[model samples]
Structures are given as structure tokens and as C-alpha cells.
Target: MESGNSIHQKPVFWQESMPELRPCHNRTVTAQRTYGGISAAERRAGRRAALLDAALEIIGTQGVDKLTVAGLCAQAGLNERYYYEQFTGRDAVLTALFDGIAEELASAIVQALQEVAGGSAADTPSAARENAANPSARRMRPETRTMAHAAVAAGIHVLTDDPRKAQVALAVSASTPELRSRTLQTIASFANLVAARGIDFYALSTPTPDPAIGFRATYLVGGLVQTLTSWLQGDIDMTREQLIDETTDVFVLLGEDLAQRLR
Candidate 1:
């Protein structure tokens, strides 16, 4: 402290006290910045959503052939960097969009079933007790038909609520081998869910190991998809209510018939 050379000396106390002043090559300080009251994460999510929506529009109109990285970014009103931020490629975007639609449809169907089953806390205790006392008798007739109608209506509503989404999910999927494969996988997954739900709802004695349930479930779900696709393409002229009613009839017929066989 007395010599001029002391001015160049390292201050150990200062270094120890202000450790943050040290140069750390590995330390990364990420500053989260917000723009227009929106956080960085929120902005990223919005960009991804915008990209997906743009992908849907392109695929729904010009088909998958037009779904290029450049084209998608242009459609989304985003830079190419933003497209890469969210997806690896055009196929990735397509898959994300399709999966989102499938998830939404699945959720809608499940909610519809729950509503029909009166699973809400708002449901009357008397009604619950009645169903509990004779679940088999209650669930077999009126409950079956009501559940069928609700589920079919809900699924149809989801698809029809956005025809562009329907087009992308149903028609556009068939345009590519990758999407077609995914479509099959999705069908099988939904079929499995249908089989499981049927067994539980009807209390069927049919062993889960049996192939009959799988076969029936696949047939029903696959047929339903085909029927809906036909309707969307205007190949089927019936009204939406007529379609739901008819579909519910088929569901009841097959479900009851299978339940009887399993019993």
C-alpha cells in the first residue's frame, strides 16, 4: 500500500468479496427479457403456435407439397430462424399439427363420455345411488345409447368446428407416406382405447388377451373415420344430426352385441 508497485498488486480481499467480477467462461447468465408485457417463453410459444396455424392453412389449401420451410415461414409471417426454433423441418410441423388435432379430438370424446356418465360433482346423489344399485341394468340400455350419442356428437363437433383442421387431419394425412403411417398408428391407439373403455363400461367377461375385442374396436374406429371423411368430402349427403344418430345406432348395435357375446 506504501509503494507505487502496490497499485498493480492483486487485491485478494476484493477478489474474494466480489467473486462475481471474475471472468467465468462456463457461467451463462441468461437474461429473460419481455416485450409488450409478454415474457420470452410466452413469445416463443406464440411463434410456435403461429407456425402451426400457418402450416395448417398451407396444407389445407395447397397440400403438403407446398409446405416448405421457406413457404411456411412466409405464411406464418415469421423468419426462417423462427421456423427452425420450433420445428426441425416441414414434416415435423405437419406431425405436430396432426398430433395436436388428434389430441383435441380425443379429449373432446373423453369429456363427452364423462358428461354422459354424470361423473361431475354437480350430479345428484340420488341418481348416483340408483346407478350404483343397478349399474348393469342402468348402463346397458339408456346409458349406452346416451353415451354413444354424446361421444359421437362431441367427436364430430370437434372435426366440423374447423373444416380446415379436418382437412389437414384426414385428407392431407393421406398425401404423404409418413403421415399415412402416423394415421394408422393413431387409429390403432384409438382402437385400443375403445376396446379398453368398452370392457370397463360393459363389464365384459371377455379376456383382454382375446383378439376379438381388438378386431372389433379397430373395425369400429376405422369405419367411423372413413364415414366422417366421406361426409366431409360431401360424398355423404345426410345432416350432422342424422350422421350422429346413425353412428350412435351402429355403436349401440355393435357394443351391445359384443357385450352379449362376451357375457
Candidate 2:
């Protein structure tokens, strides 16, 4: 292994024979080559991210229709040429932005559910025993409430923490045909994820073979999306805490009813 001092020392080939004669020229060359150095791919990806962020701001503040290439490039502080290098057009940027938010929301909800379930398994032994003794008591367990609260809070935070993400994911996507189609596909993907989680949570038989389970997942996803969209759009008037509490209650009640019906 090389010593730290040796590791940082200039290579033998990098040393100049007549150091005093070309010091300024060598320094200028090195500075030009390494200053703000980044790989081409990294630069491209960075530009793309900046453009996406600018798109979100424009879509969130103005409407989606107002998102022009010139405006987006200006907001991103990148040239129009750089915009074309990443996205084909404004619609592509919109699609990418919507997909990114949808992905984040789904991941947040899944992580929240996993954490809650793990905690419940660790800390709810007494409640679990009581639930085992009384089937009706399962839905009333402290663990159940904890899981509901965590899931709702996670989902809502993905929206509320960034208004731009909320507007792009919920509002802007619905305004155009292409974006709407992409949003619907994203919703179906999330619904499948929820359905899979439900099967595991309920310890249901594999090869589910039941259409109702799928339908129930779709219903839950659609209802939650509509509720969130309404809340973000100001159609629903409630504080963040109120929304979280009410949504958590609704989810817990829905889960209980669904669990009963599934049996």
C-alpha cells in the first residue's frame, strides 16, 4: 500500500524539467482540464434532472400547457440544445416527472408498511394474543392503528412535503391525454403492489384466483388517489394532521371491512 503522502504526490511523468520556464503555462493547462470536471454522462444526467425540476416548477405554478421548451430551458438555466439531448419534448419531461413522483410515493408507502409491520411484530405480543383469542379484536389492536397511521403519514408526506411533486403527480398528469394514460398505468402498478401486500398480510393462499381481491385493490388505490388530488387542489379543506388522522381511520376501517369480506 502506498503512503498517504506518496499517493497524493504528482507522478514522475507530470514533473517538468524546466519548472521555472513553464510553470504558468502548465498551471493554466491543468486548471482548464480539471476545473469543474465531470463525465459526459454525468453532465447529461445532471442537465436532465435540472430540466425535470424546472418542468415541475412550471407545471406546478402555471398549468401544464404553459410548459414550453424555451421557458423550461430558461428556468433550468440550460440551453435548448441540452434540453433536446435529454428529452424529446415537453411531454417527455412531463412523463418522466410524473413517473418519478409515482415511484417515490409507492416506495414511501411500502417502506412505511414494512416498518409498521416489523414494529408490530416486535412490540404487540399482548395485543396479538388478545387478537388471537378474539377475531373481532384484531382490527382494534394498537398495532393496527400504528400501521394505519404510519402508512397514511408516509403517503401524505410524499405529497405535502413537495407541492411541486403533488401538482405534477396529481394535477398536471390528469390534464393531458398522454400524461393521463401514464398516470393510469402508474396507478395500476401501485394497485398490484398493494394487492400483493394484502395477500401477504392476510396470509391468503397463493395463485389468488380471486377477481374481487384485484378489484378491491383498484378501488382502494383509486379512492386514495382521488382523495389526495382533491386535498392538494384545495377542494378538501383540512389541516395536514387532520388529513393524516382521517385518512388513517378510513384505511383501518377499510382494511377491517375488506378482511371480513375476504373471509
Candidate 3:
């Protein structure tokens, strides 16, 4: 929960740990140029990915305070010169890493929603289909619990399967000013998305939209992020399945309440 300019300041523990570079030779030059017959750009991208992975590892275990350029390059098994090929500095790399995780989480949710929508469409009753244009007509629709379960499971699985990703996205991202800002922005984007989808699902029309809808969506997003962060940091003692079930239940109940209020 760190904030402000102080989060960007380097701590006393930020020490250089660059590994000694190997001596260059004609053989090494030739090998690097044609390594696996891949282009130089591809090789550089591979090295960048390796460095990001190393950064995630360090941030997760040793903390962001120890994430020096030298240590990152050394852990990535790349030369110091190569680090600059992709990122300007450690902060840039950290930003990119968080962005990548946010994209992954967003994609998982979208995919889950798409699957749920497809199933719901296929199972719709003929009468409901005919009355699609009747604003006053209510249909026997599929419960959103299935969608909630799918989305929650998809998001949680992405984190649990990769501890490094979980740590970087949920814990380390909140430890810096730049990263914390990015995380909050990402959360807001997700909150907006959820609110939009809720409106569409419930067909709730308001000449002056209820401010409570936005507030509720933001509250849900914040709660979910904090809960997942605690679980990832081992502050919560529930099993993965238990966590998914409980979270899905909360989301389903929230959706049901919203629907009732709209009605």
C-alpha cells in the first residue's frame, strides 16, 4: 500500500551485483549473429523476455528494493548492454511487466464471458427470442453464476499456475509509485468494463444513470484485488478450489442483487 514520491526513491540496499562479462572473440560474434538462424530482433526480444522473467523473480523473492539493473542483467544471463536494447531502466521494465499481466487478466475474462454468452444464446427459449424487442417483457434467462464461476476460475488459475506472475501483478505492483498508479488505472478500467456488462445484461435503462452502479463496480473490483493479493501473499489459508468457489459465490450474489434492484 505504498504511495507518493517516496516509493520511487532507491533504498540503501540497492547495491550493484553485475556479473563479470565474458571476453569477446570472433567465434562468439559469429555465433551470436546467426544463433539458431533467428533474426537479431527476435534474439533481442527473447533476451528482453528473459530479463522480465528475472525481474519478476527478484521482485517476488528479494523485493523491488533489490531490483538493480546489474542484478537483473546477471540473473537474466545477458550482458548489461542488452538490457538497454529493450528498456530504458528498471522502472520501464516494471511497467511493461505489469502491463503484460493486466492484458492477460483482461483476456481471460473476455474469453470466459464470450463462452458464457454463446451458451446462453444457444439455450434461450423461443418465446424469449421472439419478445427480444419488448422492453417490459421478462424472460427466463440463464443464471449468471456459470459466467461468474468461469471468469473467476480463469483469472485465479492464471495466477496460481505462475507464482511469479501472481507476485508481480498482485503484490509487487503496489510497492512503487509508478506501478501503483498503473495498477489503480488498470483496476478502474476493469471496473468500467464490469459496469458496462452489468448494464447490458440486466437491460437497465436510466435517463440519469445511477451513480451507485459505478460505485458498486469499483467496490467489487477493489475488494477482489485485495482479496487475491492477500491470497497470493499467503496471508489467506484457503485452497485454490475453495477460494474460487467463495469468490464466484460473492460475484453471483452481487449480480443477482443488482438484477433485483433494476427490476
Judged by lDDT, which candidate is best? Answer: 1
For candidate 3, write residues 117-140 as lDDT tens digits.
776643445324323532222322
- List TM-scores for all candidates, in order: 0.77, 0.76, 0.73
By the TM-score metric, which is better: model 1 or model 2?
Answer: 1
Any runs in candidate 1 off by more than 4 Å, and if so which? 1-26, 119-140, 205-209
- Kindly list the per-residue Cα lDDT of model 1 for residues 180-223, writing each as its tens digit: 88788778877877887788888874434467788888898899
Question: lDDT at 15 for candidate 1?
Answer: 12
Query: Sorted by lDDT, highest first, which candidate order results?
Result: 1, 3, 2
Question: Which candidate wins on TM-score?
Answer: 1
lDDT of 2 by residue, 43-92 (tens): 66677778888888898888787799999999999999887777776666
Which segments of candidate 2 are over 4 A away from where they belong? Answer: 1-37, 121-139
The Cα error of candidate 2 at residue 114, in Å, is 2.6
Question: RMSD in angstroms, candidate 3?
Answer: 10.1
